[model samples]
Target: MTIRLASIEDHAALAGIFLSVRRSTFVWEDPASFQLDDFASATEGELIHVAETAENGIVGFISLWEPEQFVHHLFIANGHRGKGIGRALLDDLARRQPGPFRLKCVAGNSVALSFYKRSGWAQIGEGETDGRPYLLMELSKTDESTLSSPST
Candidate 1:
């Protein structure tokens, strides 16, 4: 499997992967709100990326806004779940040595909630969109700097 940064030229393929995942995972959350045109908004130098397989390709993807490091989205093709792909993506991102990381999960999405929890993210807050509540989870890289209490 290969995971790499996505370029603007990858718009079509990336959009298709996202649309497919949306149908299954985001049926209620986003519906058709996320579109192909949105790929152009990715802009290079960001953390957006796609994951491909050795043979059956474009299996999954993930992205987050820079600095804020708020996870925008992550999805694996329907048939590709249960493998370590999702975990690999998370592990790879965590290994990148960022200051802090965050992602929001729909309150009803038990699968996603559990996945994030097992990966060491703790609930910090929540958000609501269109009357649906989303639980925000965060992972702060454990380092000497973070272990120390903030000074007043």
Candidate 2:
């Protein structure tokens, strides 16, 4: 797979992945509440990167609020998880932006929480959104150093 900045042509596919992944992963949320247009709104004014494969075209995406070095979204297409697509998108972003980045993960999503933790993000705080609790995570400048170093 290859990772690159998302083009306007990639939006439709990225939106589909966003909608589908959220619908499937956030089981507690009403799937019908997720709309294709939600992608445009959520990612507006942000920098987005997409993961593409020769066969799948676009399999995943990540969006960052560059002004704050905040990662707003990261989703892999269903059937494409566990393939390192998400990590590649993240590593690409880190290489390009060199972030002390922050993001929020829904507290109920254990899999995602674990992924972030294993990714060198630490829980710095917590907050609620739409009445649901979420963990506030950050990859600090200190933590970022380790992301690039060889794991012994």
Candidate 3:
């Protein structure tokens, strides 16, 4: 397996994997929250990284925010969970994003919470917004080990 930069051609394949895993991984979220529709050519301060097999088939991805390097979204194929693909993606992003990175996890997403915790991301604070619970978490730019595994 390999992790590398993503391109427009990778969007469709990545989106397909996302859809297959969304129902279970993101059950706390709306099924359509961030479907990969307009991102086929997504650009400008956006970085989408993909984890693929040796033959170049997409399995998972993580989006790193430009300037801040905060991880925006990460997902792995439902069938590929527990295989460390998520960690590979996170490690790649951490190596590239050079700042105190941050991400939000819903209050009820125990799986995600555990993932973040095990990966070395610590909870800083939390509250609800738009009826959804949110916890503010950050990963120091130098601590690339924190995302070893997204708990769930």
Off by over 4 Å in 1: 29-35, 38-46, 142-152
TM-score of 1: 0.79
RMSD of 2: 3.1
lDDT of each: 0.73, 0.85, 0.73
Against the true structure, what is each candidate's TM-score?
Answer: 0.79, 0.92, 0.80
What is candidate 2's lDDT per residue for 1-152, written digit by digit as tens? Answer: 77888999898898899888989999989999999989999999999988888897998888999999999999999999987777777777777786789999999999999988877789999999989999999986544555543211
Clashes of 2: 0
- By lDDT, who's the top model here? 2
Model 3, position 117, has a per-residue lDDT of 78
Clashing pairs in 1: none
Ranking by TM-score: 2, 3, 1
Give candidate 3's whole-model lDDT. 0.73
Prediction RMSDs, each to the true structure:
6.7, 3.1, 4.2
